[model samples]
Target: MEFDKNFKTHSFRATFITDLLKEVPIHIAKDIVGHEVVSSTEIYYRSSLTKKDSLKILNSVDTLRFN
Candidate 1:
């Protein structure tokens, strides 16, 4: 059996950290990834929200009804 040419064990580290960031706080993600500094982890995840996306979220929030 052979793996893909680009398959490096460490290649998924960035994606792992990025997905982890989506589910956990930055400090937690940093600790999970074993980075001594948060700055090193900061470059891995991006929120990337556009103006339209923000407005969509705001509109969705407006639809919430509390009893």
Candidate 2:
């Protein structure tokens, strides 16, 4: 599929880091990117998750079962 013209190589990095944040600890994600601080890597997670994305994440949690 053709991505947007605005898409750049850094976009892939951001997406990868964002996905990593969903599955792994912040420290691990930061290490993977060779960042000195977890806060640096967290920028990708925060920016990638917009208001609409936040709602989608909450909606996905509705399907889970808990004790």
Candidate 3:
């Protein structure tokens, strides 16, 4: 068995950190990734939200009926 050029250690690291960031806080993600600086982790997981995407999230929030 052989791996291709797309297979790199950093790819796995990037994916692992990216998935972790989605569920956990940035500080925790930074600790899991073992970065001394949170900025580095922020660079990996920062996503730009489109207007439509923002509206969807806001609409979801508005639909919540708190007791």
Candidate 4:
């Protein structure tokens, strides 16, 4: 048997997931990536929550508190 050059593999899936995470919301990403459910996308493709992201949230809260 021969494999096609366009065949999907684990590394391709990983790259797709990473791009989706960077570009789209969970629900949209799920659909584009062919996940049956949002939970699956959330479980599989979610990026690590970062301190910079947290800091942005905290700054928004701080601004709200002062207004």
- Model 1, range 4-55, lDDT digits (tens) per residue? 9999856577678878888999998989888989998987765668999999
* C-alpha local distance difference test of each model: 0.81, 0.82, 0.82, 0.79
Quick one: best TM-score, which candidate?
Answer: 3
Q: Please give, for residues 1-67, the per-residue lDDT of candidate 3 as tens digits.
A: 8899688887677778878978999898898888999998876764557889999998888888551
Model 2: colliding residue pairs:
none
lDDT of 2 by residue, 1-67 (tens): 9888998988788889988888888899999999999788877774556899889888788756432
**Cα TM-score per model:** 0.56, 0.58, 0.61, 0.55
Worst 10 residues of 3 by lDDT: 41-50
The Cα RMSD of model 4 versus the native structure comes to 5.9
- Candidate number with the higher TM-score (2 or 3): 3
Clashing pairs in 3: none
Worst 10 residues of 2 by lDDT: 58-67
Model 4 regions lying over 4 Å from their true place: 1-15
Stretches > 4 Å off in candidate 1: 46-67
Candidate 2 ranges with C-alpha deviation above 4 Å: 1-4, 46-67
